[model samples]
Target: MSPLIDCLLIGLGATLIMDLWGLVRHPLLGMPLPSYYLVGRWLGHMPKGQFRHQAIAKASPVPGETLIGWLAHYLIGVSFAALLLLITGSKWLTSPSLTPALAVGLVTVLAPFLLMQPGMGAGIAASRLPNPGQARLHSLITHGVFGLGLYLSALGLRLFN
Candidate 1:
């Protein structure tokens, strides 16, 4: 496969794996993990008192927004794969090293710290969350899983290659 295509696959596969895991685990923890459309519906149904505060969370990201977010997620994955290709060439994709993958995966910090948190009105990086420490920790773990997914997928591709 072409290098760009390989990168795209790597990213998409990683995201799906992580998201699937979320679906399985979130319910066990009593959290409602809904699709973007569900989120929109829930927001519409929110009590009037909390509506202002949760406007962003309630407002389902439009299809365009969802598409853009997914594309960004994929691009982020592709970028990591591309980096691996540059560093280790064909061998990297076949058995991409965890060190680089983890390092590159750190970029996920941007999502919560900047875009998502602010949009949700939680302040930068969720500094304003009720339990900032726990929230930040959760974000870290989630992103860490994504990073691991990238590393493992790269290893799989390496073996396949």
Candidate 2:
């Protein structure tokens, strides 16, 4: 398969794995599942020149925000995969190593720590949340899982090929 196709598969696979982790964690740990609708709501307002929200949960709801958030989630995953391929080269696709994939996954936490969280009003690295430490830990673990997922997905794809 082409590099683009490989990236898509790996990215989507990794994202799906992360989502599954959330599903399992929610019931087991009493953690609430993320509402992508909020993400969509945040993104939906971008065109209107709105970027930061004191509390995204309290922000005005947007039509089709759910679909928008979900789509954006997958697209971001795919983009990450492409980024990994770009950084490590397409040769990694055939070989499918764990180190690079995991590294990229871990590094992706910066998006939420610096950009997403603050934009959604959670503050930097969720510092403004009630339990900032716990939230940060969860983000770290989730991103780590995403990194593992990247390696696992790459391995699976390599095996199939």
Candidate 3:
């Protein structure tokens, strides 16, 4: 596969794995699924020059925000995968090392910490949340899972090869 295609698959797969963790975590730990719609809503407002929200939920509803959110979620996942590829190179995609994948996943958490969470009014690193430390912990774990997914996805591709 082309490097672009590989990056896309790796990203989508890792994001899906993180999402699965979100689903299972809800039942196992009583946490709620991530509201990507809020992300969409945030993005939706950006065209109007709004970059941050005091409370994204209270922000006006945007048309197709749900679809936008889901699409953005997957796209962001793919972007992170691209970042991983940039760091590890496509050659690594062939062998699929867990360390590189996991490291990328862990580093990807910075997006939410520095950008997404704060933009959505959750505060940096979810500091605005009632339990900021717990929220941070969950975010870290989810990103780690995403990293694992990157390695797993590459392995899956190798199986087909």
Question: lDDT tens digits, residues 1-161, model 1?
Answer: 77777777777766666676668768676544624433333333343433333446556444455555555555665666576556667666755778776766666667658855665667787787788887777667667767777787766666676
TM for candidate 1 is 0.69
**Per-residue lDDT tens digits of candidate 2, residues 2-96?**
88888999999999999999998999999999658888999998999999999998999999999999999989988988889999998888788
The backbone clash count of each candidate, in order, is 2, 0, 0
* lDDT of candidate model 2 versus the reference: 0.92
Provide TM-scores for the models: 0.69, 0.97, 0.97
| Colliding residue pairs in candidate 1 | 43-58, 94-158
- Show model 3 residue runs off by greater than 4 Å: none
3-43: candidate 3 lDDT, tens digit per residue: 89888888898888899999999989999976688888999
Better of 1 and 2 by TM-score: 2
What are the lDDT scores of the predictions, listed in order? 0.63, 0.92, 0.91
lDDT of 2 at 75: 95
